[model samples]
Target: MRMRPLGRTGLEVSELCLGTMTFGTQTPPEDAHAQMERARKAGVNFLDTAEMYPVNPVRAETVGRSEEIIGDWFAKTGRRGEWIVATKHSGEGLKAVRDGAPISSKTIPETVEGSLRRLRTDVIDLYQFHWPNRGSYMFRQNWRYDPSGQDRAETIAHMEDALEALERQVEKGNIRFFGLSNESAWGTCQWLRLAEERGRPRVQTIQNEYSLLCRLYDTDLAELSANEDVHLLPFSPLGAGFLTGKYQGGAVPEGSRMSLNAGMGGRKSPRVFEAVAAYLEIASRFGLDPVQMALAWAARRPFVASAIFGATTLAQLEHALGAAEVTLSDELLEAIDEAHRDHPMPY
Candidate 1:
C-alpha cells in the first residue's frame, strides 16, 4: 500500500483507509477486531469512524459502538499507535446524538472528550465534523439543497468560534488536525480563509462520496483540492456495493447495505443500477474484478489522500485490498470516462 501526506499535517497515511462504520452493527466486536487486523496486515494504516457510527441504521443505542470496538482492539493488541485513527463529531439533524444539535464552539470540547474516552486515545489523529451545521449537498441532498436560509454573519461567527475551540484541543494535545465532511467548495474556502486570517488549524481533508456512479467531487471540489493541498478522503468508491455487480439484477444480497438501509444512503435510485451495469461491463471487458476496478480508480485520482471503504466480511476486505496492485491501463481509463459521459449522475 502506498502512503500519502495528510495535507500539511506531517502525517503519512495509507492510500486506503479502513472505514469502521459497520463495526458493532452488522459486524460484531470480534469480527470488527479481525477486520482491523486484516487491514493492518494489508498495510492500511488509517482507520475512520464517527461518534454516531455503526451506522447502517444509526440507532441511539448503537451510537459510538464502532469507536468502542476499535478502542477495545487497541487495548487487546496494543497497536493503537500503529494506526492513524480518525473520528467525527456529529452535526445537526442526527437526533440520536446530542439531541440533533449542530456542531459549534460550545460542543467541540465536549465532543472531543467523548471521542477520546470511547477511543481510549490521548489524542485523535484527525478529528472531523461529520457534516456542516449549516447543511450540505451530499447524500443526494443536492436536488433540494437550498442556501437561502443561511445567515452569513452567523456562519462566519460559528466557524471562527469553532476554530478557537479546535485550537484549544490542539494546544492540549487532544487532536492533531481537523477536517470536514459532506461540505461544499464554498464552505471549504471559507474555513481555509478563516484559518489563514486567525492562524488556526486549516481543514486538511474532506470526506465525501465519490464513485463511478457519483462523480460529484470531480469538478469544483477537485479544483479546491489541487490548489489548496486539501485532499479528498472519498467514501463509497464502490458505489455502496453497486459497482461489484452484486446488485446489478435487482438482487439485494441477503446481508448487503441495501438490505439494511433500504435506500443505501440515497444511492438506490432506479438509474443507479444502469450505471453500475456500465461500470461492471467495463470491468468485465478488461477481465478485472469490479470491486478492485472501482477502488483503484478512486485511489488514482490526483486529489485523493485516501479512499475509505467498508466491508461486512473479511473476504470482502481481502478482495478490496487487491486493488493496491491492480493498475488500470490507459485504455480502461478512457473507457471509464466514456461510461461516465453515457450515464452521469445516476442519483
Candidate 2:
C-alpha cells in the first residue's frame, strides 16, 4: 500500500484505511481481528471508526462497541503502536451519545476520554468530528438543505470554543491531529482560519461520501482539498454496496446492508440502479472485479488521502484488498468519466 501525507501533521497513512463500523454488529470479534490482521499484512496501517458505531441500527446499548472491539485487538496483539487509528466524536441529532448533544467545549474533553479508554490507545493519531453541529448535506440531505437561517456569529463562537477544547487535548497529549466529516467547504475554511489565528491544530482531513453514483465532493470539496492541504478521506467509496453490483436487479442477499436498512440510508431511488448498471457494465468490459474497480476508481482521485472501506466478512475484506494493487488505464478512466456525465447524482 502506498502511503500519503496526512496534511502537514508530519504523518503518512496508507492509501486504503480499514473502517471498523461493522465491528460488534455485522462482524464478530474474532472475525474483526482476523480482518485487521489481513489488512496489516496488506500494509494498510490506517484504521477508522466512530464513537457511535456498529451502526446498521445504532443503539445506545451498542454505542462504542466497535471501539471496544478494536481495543481488544490491540490488547490481544500488543500491536497498538503499529496502526494509525482514527475515530470520531458523535455530533448532534444522535441520541445514542451524550443525549444528542452537539459537539462543543463542554463535550470534547469527556468524548476524548471515552474514546481513549475504549480504543486502548494513549493518543488518537487523527481525531475527527463526525459531523457539523449546525447540520450537513450528507446522508442524502442535500435535496432540501437550507443554511440561510444559521447565525454566523454564533457559529464562529462555537468553533472557537471547540478549538479551545481541542487545544487542551493537544497539550495533554490526547490527540495528535484533527479532522472533519460530513462537513461543507465553508465550514472547513472557517476551521482552518480559526486554527491559524488561535494557534490551535489545523484541520488535517475530511471524511465524506464519494462513489461512482455520488460525486458530491467533485467540485468545491475537491478544490479545497487540493489547495488547502486538507485531504479527503472518502467513506463508502462503493456507494453503500451499490457500486459492487450485489444489490443489482433487486437482489438483496441475506445479511446484506440493504436487508437491514431497506432504504440503504436514503440511497434507494430509480436512478441509483441505472447508475450502478452503467458502472457494472464498465467493470465487465474492462474485465475487472466490480468491487475492485469501484475502490480503485475512488482511490485514484487527486485529493484523496485514503479511501475508508468496511467489510462484514473475511472474504469481503480479502476481495477489497485487491484494490490496493489495481490500476486503471487512461481509456478505462475516460470511460468512467463519460459514465459519470451520463448519470450524475443518480440518487
Candidate 3:
C-alpha cells in the first residue's frame, strides 16, 4: 500500500485506512480481531475508530465497544506499537454520548482519559473531535446547517483553551497530533490560524464523507485541504455499500446497513441505486469490481490522504485492501468520469 504524509506532521500513513466502526456491532470480537490481523498483514498501518462507535444503530449501551475490541487485540497480541491507531472524541447532539455534550476545554482531558482507558493505551496517535461542538454539516446535515447560533468570541476562547490542554497532552505523550471530523473549511482555517499564532498543534486532517455519490468535499474543503496542509481522510468512499451494487435494484439485502439504519444516515434515495448501476456498468465494461473502481477513484483524488473503509467480514476487507494494487487505466478513468457526470449527487 502507498503511504502519504498526514498533513504537515511527519507521520506517514497508509493511503487506505482501516475503519473499525463495525467492530462490535455487526462483527463479533473474534471476527473483529481477525479483520485487524488481516488488515495489518495486508500492509495497512492505520486503524481508525471512534469512542462512540459500533454505530449502525448507536446506543448508550454499546458506546465504546469498538475501542474495547481493539484494546482486546492489543492485550492479546501485545503489538500496540505495530500500528498507528486514530480515534475520535464524540461531539454534541449524539444522544448516546454524554447526552450529546458540547466539546470544550472542560471536555478535553476527561474525554481523552475515557478513550485511553477504553483502548487500553497510554496515548492516542491522532485524537479528533468526532464532530464540531458548535455543529457540523456532515451526515446529511448540510441542508439545515446553520451558523447563526454560534458565538464567535466564545468559540475562539474555547479553541485556545483546548489548544493549551492538547499541548499539555502532547508534553505528557498522551497524543501525537490532533485532527477534526465533520468540520467545515472556515473552522479548519481558524484552527490553523490559532495553532500558528499560539504555537499549538494544528489540525492535521479532517474526516469527511466523500464518494462518487457525495462530492461535498470536492469544492471549498478541497482547496483548504490542498493549501493548508490538512489532509482529507474521506469516510464512506463507497457510499455505504450503495456504490457496490449491493443495494441496487431496490433489493435491500438482509443484514445490510440500510436494514439496520433505514435512512442510512440520509443516504437512502431512489436515485442512489440508479447511480450505483451506472458505476457498476462501467466496472463491468472494464472487468473491474465496482468496489475497486469506487475506491481507486477516491484514492486518486488530489486532496485525499487516505480513503477510510469498513467491512463486516474478512473476505470483504481483503477485497478492499487490495484496491491499492489496482491502478485504473486511463480508459477506465474516462469511463468513470463519464458515469460521474451522468449522475452527480444521488443523496
Candidate 4:
C-alpha cells in the first residue's frame, strides 16, 4: 500500500485505511483480529474507527464495542505504535452516544478519556468530530438541507468553542491532530479561521462520503482540500456495496447492508441501478473487477489522502484489498466520465 501525507502534520498514512466500524457488530472479535492482521501484512498502516461504531444496527449497549475490539488487538499484538490510529467523537443525533447530545466544550475532555481507555492508547493520531453540532449537509440530509435560518455568528462561536476543546485535548497529549467530517467548505473555513485567530491547531483532514455514485466532495471540498492542504478520508468509497454489482438484479444477497436497511439510507433508487450497471460494464470492458475500479477511482482522486473502507467477512476484506493494486487507465476513466455525464445525481 502506498503512503500519503496527512495535511501539514508530517504524519504519513496508508493510502487505504482499514476501517473497523464493523468490528463488534457484523464481525466477531476473532474475525476482526484476522482482518487486522491481513491488513497489516498488506502494508496498510492506518486504522480508523469511531466511538459510535459497529453502526449497522447501532445500539446503546454496544456503542463502544468497536474500540474495545481494537484495544484487545493492541493488547494481544503488543504493537500499539506500529500503525497510525485515527478515531472520532460522535456528534449529536445518535441516540446511544452522550444521551444523544451534541459535542461541546464540556464534552471533549471526557470523550477523549473514554476513547483512550477503549482504544488502549494514551494518544490518538487523528481525532475527528463526526459532524458539526449546528448541522450540515451529510448523511443524505442534502435533499432537505436549508442553511437560510442558520446564524453565522452563533455557528462561529460553537466552532471556536469546539476548537478550544480540541486544543485542550492537544495540550493534554490525548489528541495530536484534529479533523472534520460531514462538513462543507464554508464550515471548514470557519474552523480554520477560528483556529488561526486563536493560535490553535487547525483541522487537518476531512472524512466524507466519496464514491463512484456519490461525488459530493468533488467540487467544493476538493478545492478546500487542495488549497488548504486538508486531506480527504473518504468513507463508503464503494457506494455502500452498490458499485460492486451485488445489487444489480435487485438481489439483496443475504447479510448485505441492503438486508438490514433496504433503502440503504435513501441511496437505493430507480436511477442508481442503471448508474451501477454502466460503471460495471466499463470495468468489464477494461477487464477490471468492478470492485477494483470503484476503490481505485476513489483512491486515485487528487485530494484523497486515504479511502476508508470496511468488510463484513474475511473474503470480503480480501476482495477489497485486491483493489489496492489496480490502476485505472485513461480509457477506463473516459468511459466512466461518459457514464457520469449520462446519469448524474442518480440518488
For TM-score, the strongest prediction is 2
Model 2: residues >4 Å from true position, as ranges?
none
lDDT of each: 0.92, 0.93, 0.88, 0.90
> Pairing residues by index, what is the TM-score of model 2?
0.99
lDDT of 3: 0.88
lDDT of 4 by residue, 1-347 (tens): 88899988998888889999889988999999999999999988999999998888899999889999999999998999887999998998888998978888988888899999999998999999999887878888898999998998988888888888888889989999999999999999888888889998888999998898888898988998999999999999999999989998979899889999989999999899999999988988999999878988898899999899899999998998988899878888899988988988677
Candidate 4's displacement at residue 168, Å, is 1.3
lDDT leaderboard ranking: 2, 1, 4, 3
TM-score of each: 0.98, 0.99, 0.97, 0.98
Candidate 3 residues lying further than 4 Å off, grouped into runs, are: none
How many collisions between residues are there in candidate 2?
A: 0
lDDT of 1 by residue, 1-347 (tens): 98989988889999899999899988899889889999999899999999999887889999999999999988888889999999999999999998999888889999899999999989999999989888888989988989999999999999999999999999999999999999999999999999999999999999999989889999999999999999999998888888888887678899888897788877787788888888888999999989999999998899999999999988889999999989899999999999999999999
Question: Could you tell me how far off, in angstroms, the CA of residue 183 lies in candidate 2 after the best superposition?
Answer: 0.5
Question: Positional deviation of 166 in candidate 2, in angstroms?
Answer: 0.2
The most accurate candidate by lDDT is: 2
Please report the TM-score between candidate 4 and the true structure: 0.98
Candidate 1 TM-score, C-alpha based? 0.98
